[model samples]
Target chain A: MGIPIYPVHLEDPKLQGFYDGLAAGELRITADTETGEWVWYPPEIVTGRPDATLEWRTVAPIGSAYTFTTVVRSLLPGDHKAEVPFTVVLFEPDEAPGVRIPGVLVDADGIEPACGMRLRLKPVRAGDHIIAGFAPAQ
Target chain B: MKAGGVAITGVGETPFIRGSDDTVLQMIARAGLDAIADAGLTPADIDGFVVNQYTGHGSDELAHVLGTGERRFAAVADSAGGTATTGHALMLAQLAIEAGLATHVLVPYAIRSTKPGGVYAFHANEPHKAAFEMPVGFFAQPTYFASMANRYAHEFGMTEEELAAVPMTYRAWAALTPGAQKREPMDLDTYRRSPMISTPLRVADCCLTTDGGGAYVVSAVERARDMPHPVVAVQGIGLAFNNWPHGVLFTQKPCTFEFPGEASAQRAYAMAQVGPDDLDLAQIYDGFSISALVQTEMLGLCERGQGPRFYAAGHGMPGGRMPINTSGGHMSGGYVPGINLLIEGVRQLRGQEGQRQVPDGGNSHATTILARN
Candidate 1:
């Protein structure tokens, strides 16, 4: 399976921290500044706390696959024919319980991907940018 | 009855076709006219309208298109997707009729899947999706649902054959349905032969793409007796939202496959003063095999995690104890969302669906349950 290659269009500048975290070789997630509680996918208003500010903090890369799927057909906006049959997994950080970060599973030659399978963060460079990637942790 | 009762008096739909030259408005106009006529009423009789927000049309627009006079009530079903078409639209219509805001209310919805940008365009516009999920190639409905199917199988136990049974069950119904988009016979082997879009989810496992429109009229149950068809009362309808926004829906739910429909089912059953066992048949919005089966469990049709096995046991098929989607659901019939399923329910109550009609138990009553996330 080839690496998925697609442009990351960040409409909200707040999300740039995620990609920045990746560039710095770390898995970062958003949390409310006051409570320091994890809020995933980075919603604009932070639920009920309009006054709360979002802060990105690097968490332990070791986690387990919450759920995953192998995309035999690429449904990205443009043609991604070369990136067929890639498994996209929702990974839960060891520190965060409900927070899930979506990424493509990597470096599992014979290890079958399943829910709760141990994995570690391994950022992968597709075309021009790096995206979240998880490799099986033995 | 209650609140003078609001029953679905008339239903109409354009043919389920792969592609149509007609604009969305044109299809709505045609279907609207047919539904009014089916109700044994003229355009002048319809004074209230409940329109879908996705259709991008207003009540004033429908009035202009249908040539209706003196519009008294107009509201939009903001509940997006199939829920808007089936659940929310019906609730709005019932509210309008009960409030005496309008007499005859029309609910219309149409989908042009082949339109430019296609259906995924809406998702693409989601800023969170663009920045986070899309870059990883985890976009598209099939991919999203496929992931859920895999996780559901792991947690709840679903075999390959069990998953195939969902669409296969619906296809059998489609074979008997005249205007169904796909009516071909599909056995287990045939299902195996179908191309896989994502693992465990073949093309057959997903909802069909078609350009079609369906409309229904709702009026007081007392007035429905004067109409053309049997009075299929809106016995009970309960709509529930888990409160997950579109951006976080796929990834953030406590259980990724959870739709939170059990609450809705309980409310519906209470309102109708009936339970799951009391229904003669049911019509579920089958957008994908996974979500359909999950909702089936939520509706208490079978034990939790037994939706796939329910079909594998042939319970949802023809001559089964509990028939579901008497008309081919979205998977086989056509993907005009929930409106077609609503039309099919009304048709079955009228006992007009020749070969596919569920056998009546004297007076026909079907409890339709559908949910979307």
Candidate 2:
């Protein structure tokens, strides 16, 4: 099946770094310039300080498979309908203790997914859009 | 003047079934009319309106049909999910009545999402959906709950038999409910034969998508005593949000297999000046059987990871301690989101549930907590 273009809102300034990093094959995160707090999902401001400066920080792509589920039946209409039994994994970055990110576990279709398995980011082009996912780290 | 001084004077619900010929708007009107009648009040008495935000059904439309002239308060509960909507509405109504903003507040919830293509395409249009969720094929509601079930099973050593017993318990209660969608007896054998919608979650584990509605009439506790029905006090009210970012998939939750129920219930119980031991019956939200278990656990009815065993042992059945979802709950009772659960809670407290009534009902509470991504 041909890869379909899933819509991504790059117009959001808080989330612009995420999409840009995916396109660049890097996992970019937001960190507080003043408090040194690492934010996995982008936010408008730091934890407590609205005046704290924020900047994009790149971390190692390696993470552990926190938890996951297999979609045996497709709830969507388009190309996803044909992609049944695909594994969706939530990975916990080694650098970020509490933050967890969700993505598809690419490759290893017949392999049963296990918790605490090591994985790495694998951003690839799907049609005109870049989709980010995770694969077992070498 | 106190927060818990408000009361649910009347309760009404449209038939919970697989298909309804009535439109959502018509159902809302009927429920409102029935509630007003139950409360022994005229439509002119209602000056406040609250509705579920999902249907885009405005309070003005409801107020117009109900003849609630010159509405003083009109609002919609947050449509985050089915769990917290009812609580949010009741809390708002209580505040309005306490603040002297409105005398009688009408809260009604209606849905037609069970029909063909009605609920299957319920995709959240948040900025996060397009980025994380949709691309991974986590489209429907069950997939998210299924993920929670899998993680719960792995972490807590939840057995398949334990999981299957939940629906069986609800079916036993539903058998007594006349208007319930699934009245057939569902034993463990039947549950095992059901197909898998997702891993660790079978078809029997999910809630019904009924096209129906439910409504409640709220007024001052003093006025409720003089009304037509028994006064069910709006005792304790608590709300907790898990701070999970929108569009984050279920697996990425800050705490999987755990809702903010502990904190919310603690606040509610404290406000009511009652603990889990004080509750005689509970109308727990059962969007899925697992959700019911989680809610029960978090409510302090049983220890964590021991909910399935507690439910299976008949403690939640009629005539048992802490009878739950006596109206069959969302699973077998026809899911009108969480509004029906609230109505049932009031019914139990009022001794209105005929055969399903808890024997000499004790302090009753209706509550739901959901942490969505």
For each candidate in the order shown, give its overall lDDT on alpha carbons. 0.84, 0.75
**Mind giving the per-residue lDDT tens digits that candidate 2 earns over A19-42?**
688888888777887778886555
Which residue pairs come into collision in candidate 2? Answer: B247-B373
For candidate 1, write residues B1-373 as lDDT tens digits: 2522788887889988987999999999988888989999899999999999899999888899899869899989887777788778888888888888899999988889989888887888888889989988889889889989999998889999999989999999999988999998999999999988877788989999889999999898878887877777776777788888888789888888898678777867777777788766777878899998998888888999888789889998999888888788899998888888878877776778887777763122223332100
Tens-digit lDDT track for model 2 on B268-303? Answer: 887877788877777777878888899899889999
Residue B98's lDDT within candidate 1 is 84
Q: Kindly list the per-residue Cα lDDT of model 1 for residues A1-138, writing each as its tens digit.
A: 677999999999989999999999999999988899998888888788788898999999999998998888787877887788888999999999899899999998677889899999999998999999999997
Taking the candidates in order, what DockQ does each have? Answer: 0.87, 0.38
Worst 10 residues of 1 chain B by lDDT: B364-373
Deviation from native of the Cα of residue B233 in model 2, angstroms: 2.0
lDDT winner: 1
